[model samples]
Target: MKKIFFARPYRFIFFPLAAAAFLSLISFIVMHLWNYLLPGLLHVDMITFWQAMALFVLCKILFGFGGRGKFGGGAPCMRQKMEERLKHMSPEEQQRFKEQFSNRMCHKSGHWGRRDWFGEEAKQEDKKAD
Candidate 1:
């Protein structure tokens, strides 16, 4: 995997500063949005900056923080999963699966016709293709 552009030693120096600025900016925006929209539109109380920060944390907890499976969210994205699977496949199987996957993904007609939506029919079609 690729490391960040700056060197590793510098990341400890830079990351916290960047994260603090990002969190402050996001909190400010959320506070402004809540103040501008909710009170007038729905008669809800306007939120303070601290309230907005709390809301942000709450949302991160309820949903997910990022796509690294940190919050016990569902599986990682498809490309990562496919890459891991490909690492375990033999060379010939990997090549064949890649071509077949590309053809089906590109919606080639013979790769998957209308009848392929049905299980038995699809199996028969696959046998015939082979």
Candidate 2:
């Protein structure tokens, strides 16, 4: 008779054990760095190991999980939607739409020092015309 080996039971135990070990090591590094640097440099109190772990968790919460945001890939999805909409428009309509959008963006405030999308020479010609 052959015996069947079950890998699933081992996987469940291994992953949590690995994660806990990683978190412990990271937290220990955080505690030592904070205790070594901040107290003397910033005149702040040194944190305990648990406090370091909490600080790491707090940072992960406040900033993100290392993507653009919580949901991720926002800009690419928006670009795809815009491309789908543009595909249905005729050439003339697309040109008109692009011109209107470009004009609105160029005239808006707080865009100083950025090169025009049309290029530097076109911008100089526009300045000369004005």
Candidate 3:
């Protein structure tokens, strides 16, 4: 009645085989790239296929498996809740809310751009340091 890539028994067999093949291919690429780049560029030793797989796993653990975008970038429902709250606020309240949000997010110094947190005070500090 329904068309599927693999039937019941084949599904179990096919998925694991596919996953293993994918992992193997990825590890092979990682091994080749590390051998090609890092050994000469960073003077790191060339890694084997198993080592590359381990490195991939280690990176996945250290960073993440990849999901959200950035810090404080919450889920869609959270965004909707924020928008609903903002809609209820007055002009002054909205401005205050925006300022608070900016402060918490990437609007301050050490974030992205050259804009300092203390504005001119940070420039003076930098001059003193220099």
The C-alpha lDDT values of all candidates are 0.77, 0.79, 0.80
Please provide, for model 2 over 31-106, each residue's C-alpha lDDT reduced to its tens digit, 9 standing for 90 to 100: 9999999999999998999999999989989987765553435588887887898899999978966785566555
Q: Kindly list the per-residue Cα lDDT of model 1 for residues 1-130, writing each as its tens digit.
A: 3564444668787899999899999999999999998899999998889999999989999986776442335555876798799999999979977766655544546533422333354588889999
Predicted model with the maximum lDDT:
3
What TM value does model 1 have?
0.49
lDDT at position 51, candidate 1: 96
Candidate 2: which stretches are off by over 4 Å? 1-6, 68-130
Give candidate 2's error at residue 81 in angstroms: 22
Candidate 3 lDDT tens digits, 12-96: 6889999999989989999999999998999989899999999988998998877666655568799999899999999998897
lDDT of 1 at 70: 26
TM-score of each: 0.49, 0.48, 0.48
Residue 42 in model 3: lDDT: 96
- What lDDT is obtained when candidate 3 is compared to the true structure? 0.80
